[model samples]
Every structure is written in structure tokens, then in C-alpha cells.
Target: LEGADGPGLFNAAQTLRQLVTRESSKGKGSKGDKGSRGFAGVTVRDWPASPVRGITEGFYGDAWSQQERLEQLDFLGRTKQNRYLYASTDDPYRQSSHWRDPYPAAQRAEFRALAERARRNHVTLGWAVSPGQGLCFSSDEDRRALLRKVDAMRALGFGAFQLRFEDVSYSEWHCDEDARTYGSGPKAAARAQAELANAVARHLSARHPGTEPLSVMPTEFYQDGATDYRSALAEKLEQGVQIAWSGVGVVPRTITGGELADARSAFRQHPLVTMDDYPVNDYAQDRIFLGPYRGREPAVASGSAALLSNAMRQPTASRVPLFTAADYAWNPKRYDPEASWEAAIDAVAAGSGTEEAREGAREAVHALAGNDASSLLGGRESAYLRPLLAEFWAAYDAADSDKKSEVKRLRRAADQLLDAFGTMRTARERVPDALEREVRPWLRELARRGEAGEQAVKMLTAQARGDGGAAWDARLALKQLRADGPERGAVVGKGVLADFEKRALETSERWAGVRRKAFGDQTVHGGPTARPDSPAEAAVDGDPDTAYRA
Candidate 1:
């Protein structure tokens, strides 16, 4: 325990399973209705220490079997997780335009029957109906086709629907595919997206009356370009359409907290809905590289909190729904990522922590490191080697050529790590932490380099884009003041060449100097500072604004 790395934590979990489950089995517990072991008076402080709980549903539209759904639901209910947002598109009940094709009218009745079955299990089936051609208006026929699907959902007891436009049209074309095919711009796409959402909402409101409200995934417009989406469909968004916020290629676009809040405020006034979409990124949008089955390694797979926090930092006018890519297409809000991972692990464990259980723990720990490595590295530079290459873009835009060359080298390293990850993913033995210790320092170095690289790229990108160096520099300085990661401290502690870099580094060092002695001795080499002193408890708390102004 004293010398644990990612693999160590994983092995510890494995050993803990043996200790906990074997101990659990030795005692004969109260018999259940079916003679299954049952616990009596189990007191649990069960809750995610974080606010963002992820919903994961089945993959490839496959039914998760009713047993799987129930198991996940039970754990989530215990965890107080409020959102169930990922239902697979291939769900048996999912209705496309040609409903008659999948099943005859009589068999379709059975699909409707499953809707109640879903609700009875404390799950709401979010209907996924394609409203129009990619971000554009569909023919009157297709529109009616979609409406019919919505009508069926109401009859079956669905409360919400997301006009999922991501897969329907031009990959990154303006909002609507149908419209884009007809040569439309952002405004046209927005109008179509907004109109379709409103039509569905009106139908649901009238047909079901107190059913859940309606929402849609605004086109991929927010994915790139155009700061103010208003020009495209601000009016439609204002009119009550929901916009889906997703940062597809890289980190979230640098829009400030205030700007996002203001946009949400304006849209809410129009009776509009605003929601963000977060697809777990370690793989391509369509596929997730989970271990053995299509399941992901545990750590990278359990990214529900990170997604939730991305939304939480914004205005909560409405609870924004986050869905897995496919589930978002199926009923949008029925999958739970955390529950999914736990279920997968439990299934693999099979109610016991044998050798297989240890292997599962090992995989889970690997995920934790991979997911946390990006943040730990500060940016991309230090973490570009093979397994970590997914984080490569974080370093690619370096202003200095030498730094850029280093990024390429790191990417090659990441490739090797990924090869090992693939082997470890299927390995049966519980591997030791030392097996991967060779890359620990490299990962740390990446974090150090990433911090400096981020600052440099921020400045150069701004200048290249002609945003005026001084204003961007000033904004950059302020950002550094509030930023808290390994890279910032390292750059500041060691010093970087650019004056702004030097200044940011100085401020970082000074803050650390005061906060270190105040909070506790600094522990930079291993990881984030490990002390219990809150910001309010620190000496700097005496003058909050001034302390932040540093």
C-alpha cells in the first residue's frame, strides 16, 4: 500500500476482493426469497463523492437483457444517481420510419408492451426519432414518419426525446444533413432543428399531457467555429430548442464561464432547452475500446463525473442530459456509465473475487491512470507516447519547433504503451505495478512539459489568429493565476523563456510558496499536493480577491 502505482491500486482492489468476498462467503447470511444470500440491516453511506454520475446503456442497440438493466438500476438507485441517459439505438423497442419492416403490427404491440416494462423498472425510455435530414428539414413524409414514432412513444409512456442530429447528416456539416444536402447554411439548419424539436414537443404535450418534457441535440455547430451560435439559430434556440454542447476534436473551446451562462439564460427565456453532449473520447465516436467484450477498461470507461462536471460548471436552468453516442441516439437518457462499469465488473467477478477478479481490478487501475494522466500531465507535451497519444493534440500546437519535435517523440512512445495496454486488457494474470513503472517518469515529464507548452501555444495560436497579442496575453496571465496543475507549477518553479511564460511561472511559484508552508509541505514529485487544508483554511484566505489577483 505504501508504494502503490496504478497497477498497485489495481492489485490492492483484487486482494481486497478476495478478502471481502471470501470473508463475506464464510458467513451464512439470511436466506432470500429464492434462497440467495441476503444481508440484514445493511447501512450504507453509498454515494459518488462527485456530482456527475454517468449513465451507460447496452452497445450496438443490443438489449442489455432485463437482468442487466435491473442490476444497474438497483445500484444506481442506491447511489442516488438522478440521470439514466444511455439507451442503445438497437434496443428492441426503438422505432425507425419503417416500423412495419422490423415487425408486423401484432409484433409491434409487443414492443409497446416493453415500454411499460421499462418504466416499471424505474427507467424512462427516451425516444430517438430522426426529425429531418442532417440538421435540415425532412420531407413532409419523413416528418410525419417521425411524428408517428413520437406518437407511439407517448402511447408507450416515454417522457423525453433528443433530436439527435450528429449521425443523421454531414459529419460536421452545418446542423442538419437534409438541409446541408440541399445547400443550406447555419441559419437554415438551426431553423429546421428548432422547428423539428418544437413539433415533437407539441405532439407529446398534447398526446401525453403530463409526460416528461422534450429536448434535442442542436447540430454540431457548437463543435467548432462561430462563438455566437445566435447567428445560426439563436432565435430557434431562444424559441425553446435545446442545443447539444460537445467538444469533438480537442479540449472544450475556450468560451468563458460567464458567456456560456449568458447564452443559457437567453435560451431559457425563449422556452428553449440547452443540453451538453459528452461522448467518452478514448476511442472513435462509433466504437468504445473496452476490454474482452466491447466494454472499455474501467478507469477510462468511468468518465461520468468528468462529463457531469463539464456541465455543472454552467447554469443549471435545466438538468442537461449526457448520453453515450449510441444511447443518445436510442432513448437518449437511459444509460448509466458508472453503473455500466460496475455491472460489467461484477459480472466478470460473478459475485466472487477469484483470480479473475484480481485481473479485473488490474484493468480498472489502468483506466484510472489513463483517464487521469491527461489532467496530471497538465497538457499534451509530456504525455504524447503511444498509450498516451490520445492526449497528443494537447501538445501539437507548440510555438517552438524543438517542443513540437519532442511531441512527435512522445507520440511514438504512446504507441508502445497502447500495445501493452492491449495485451494487459486481455491478460488473465494480475500484473504488478512495476511492469509499467518504466513510463511513470515519462508521464510526469510530459506533465511538466505540457504546462509550459500550453502557455506557449495559447499565445501563438491567439497571435496567428490575429486576436491581438496584448489582450490575449493579459487573458492568458489571468488564466494562469487560477490554473492549478503540475505543468504550471513546474514551469513557474523552473522558469520558461517567454516573458509571459516567465511571469505566469513566477506567479505560480509565489502562490505555491505561500500556500505550501500554509497548507503543508509540497509533494510535487509524486502527484497533486496531498493535504487537507481547504482554500478557505489557507493563509491566503484572509484576502480572497487579493490572493486570487496574484
Candidate 2:
């Protein structure tokens, strides 16, 4: 800590804070504890692997409230993140639609407060402007408008600036002025963007001396190899201006050292920074991803100047992954995703300051983490359900006497899971209100599904034993309960229930056919399918007649 400066010093302070939190939580000086009274013999020397490690509120959703943003700044400080980019798509002024508009009095005040908070937390607040949508790269008026916006934000105390030309078409100039000035082509587009970025950097320096170099996110920010536009941009852009890249794809599954090297080469090594889109569940709003920040190799830290995660819309849930991102950015060489995930859970639980609260928070987060619809069968929820499913299926496929035991076991497992959900629902005081609000509906639906799943298992058992009446009763009960359909406003667990319903119905139908064959010359009352008046019933049975009616 003695020699560290800038981000390094911030990282050291965070490490010390973590160490203290860990030690105190161990009851080091408590009356009943017999541990050491002083420090727990912990020694720490730490620095970030990347120079700039932070997050970008750059998702497409309702922007985080001012209070949420303030909390996020504090969270960033706690995790040793040294940078924060304010580039939410929800903000019109931040992007092209209203690029020239100044923040209103109240919004400006919020920005001022945010900037002060960021300064206090030792985080560099970077404001990004996206004017590429309607900009005339050749007009003085456009240039002035762009610089004026930056000047306004600079007056509010944001020293770092980024010009984002992403997601906009550059096939032809938007304005006739630019079309006349620079012909329509990739080279022209790159030249225009690079020149404008250089101009912004120089303007900021001249107006606000000692400001950090400007950052730029190009239109073609992701590529496996260099292109003509990239080469033109590299040739035209200033060396002091940093550039942001989002790997080979916008949301790449992986970022390797070779990709970083390619990006460096493509950008002519203009202090490259990674704008990672992982763990940002905005695109997949139906669920929240609580998994570790992964896919980027450790070597990426050394190859890039910095790594900044683009967070999910749910700020509280995003913390689970951001914590791991911080750990990886701080020490990628020895980073372990699983270890980091455990540490993240502990860190979140530590905030509660009570053993019961910690356990409750951990369980709640663990359940919510499985809400990632993208990896439905691969998360914590699936892990919990998979074993029970295997047991139920094994027992069903076993001897006749074993079916009853297996069915009972499956019902018990379902009840236990439902009970866990009940505990999570009732532990609202223990978990963060934000997280509780974000995940409550999903949990409710999960409990309901557990109930329905147990019932479905029972129905299957009855059908396997040729008890049509029992099977019919169980099916009718499940339909009446409306447990097979997803809960209203629930983003996760839709696929989970849908898959279960499909498999259960298929298995039930197959068993019914086997029963009919065994009885011989029998008539099937429902003729392979039954339609109920209730929409939920239709939903469960996959009845086309009422499937889309609701």
C-alpha cells in the first residue's frame, strides 16, 4: 500500500477492507470467541492486473435510479473497481437521438452528485456521447454541438470522456455535408470518426487541463481480424486516445489472448480496453445470471489495458458476477471461477452481519442465480432438481414395487424444494430489498412448479400401475391448480416448467398407450388428448385450441 498510487492504491484499500471484514466476521474480538484479539495474521500486497478495472451502465433498459447509482459507486469502491462509464442507452442525451441536448437542472444536479460520489470513492467517472446516428462529421455546427455537450459534462466534473460510434450505420454519411466532404465508404466513415475523436480529445485537453485521454468505441468494435475500416481508424486516431473493444463478437462466449492481440494490432495498440458484455443479462431479461465472470482467459488481462464489465439491468443481482470480475481483473493469473463465486456469495452475505441473515441471503442468491433462462438446465436450480428427477425416473423404470417408493421420494424432494422457496420468500428482511423485488415472482413460480411437478409424478405413477381414475384425478387437480404455467412477470423458470410439462405429458401419454394395449380391445375415452375450459389447463396440456387464445 505504501508505494501504490491511483487504481493501485484504491485496490490496496479495498483489499484491506475485505481483510478486516473477513476477520471481524470471524468473531475475532467477541466475548465468546477465543481467536486472536488483534489482526488475524493477514498480510496483503495487491494491485489490479488491468490498469482500468470497472463497470459500464451501458445496458438497454430503464437506467438505474440516482440512489442505485450511488450505491453502485460504493460497491465499485468496495470491490476495487477504479472506473465507471455512464453510457446507458436509456439516456437520450448520452446517445444520438438527443446528443445535443443539455441535461435539465434536476438531472444535472444528479450528475453532479454522482461525480462527487465517484471522486470520493476514487472511481474515475467516464461519460460517453454517441452522436454518430445523425452527425455530419464535416460540419462545424455538429462539431461545436458535440464538444459543447462534452464541455457541459466536464463542467459537472467528469474528467474522462468516450465517443461511442457503435451500433450506427456508416455505409453513407447521415448529413449531406459529410457526404460531400468525405465520400461514402468504410474508409470515409473511419476517417470521420477518428478525426472527430481526436478533435474531442484535443478540445478537452485545451479546455480542462490535466484531464484523462478520451475513449472511443468504434462502429465495428468486434472482429476476429483487422478490416479496412479498422486500419483506417488506427492510422487516423491519436495515440493518446484509448479505444474500447467488445471481443470478436458483441457478446462473445469467450475472449482469448490471441483475440486481444488481434484487437491491439487492429487498433494500432491505442491503449486498448475491453468492454465485456458477459453477465449483462439485459438482452436476456427473462432471467438474471449469477454465475462467475468467465470465458476471458487470464492472459487477456496482460494483453489489454483494462477490463470493464457491462452490467445487467438488475443492479443488485449484477453484483454477484461483478465481484468475480473484480477478482479476475485484480489477479487473473491465479483466478479460479468457482473460488471467486464462493467469495462473492460470502461478500454479499457479509453485508447482513448475522449468521442467519448470511445463510438466508446465500440461499436466496443461490436460488435466484439459477434464473438464467439461457442456461436453464445448467445452473443451481437445475443442479437441485436433476438428482430428484433421476431418482424419480429410476424408480419409475424399476420394478413395480419400487415405483411407489420412487414416487414418494420425488414428492419429498419437491416438497423440500418448495419449502426452501418458502423460506426465501419469507426472508425478505434478510436479503437486499432490490434483489427480493427482482426475484420474488420467479421464486413464487418455482414453488408452484414444484407442486405441479410432484403431482405430475404421482399421475405418472398411477398411470404406470393402470389406475386410469387416479391418473385422471391427479391430472385434473394439476390443471385446476394452474401450476404448470409460468408466473406473471416471472422471467426465469418458464423453460424449466415447459420442459417438465412436455416430458411429463409425453411420458403420461406413452404410459396410457401401454395400459390400453395391456387391457386389449379397449376404447380410450379422451382419444389421445383432453381439452379443459381453463386457459391454464390448455397451457399445461399443450392444447392448440386454447394455446394462443389467452
The candidate that wins on lDDT is 2
Q: Give one digit per residue, the lDDT tens place, for model 2 in 67-134.
A: 98999999999888878999988988877789899989999999999999999888888898888887
Candidate 1: C-alpha RMSD after superposition: 20.5
Q: Provide the lowest-lDDT 10-residue window in model 2.
A: 541-550
Instruction: State the number of backbone clashes in model 1.
Output: 40
Q: What is the TM-score of each candidate against the true structure?
A: 0.42, 0.82
RMSD of each: 20.5, 6.4
Residue 512 error, candidate 1, Å: 46
What do the candidate models score in CA lDDT, each in turn?
Answer: 0.38, 0.74
Model 2: residues >4 Å from true position, as ranges?
Answer: 1-3, 23-39, 349-354, 373-381, 391-430, 453-477, 481-484, 493-550
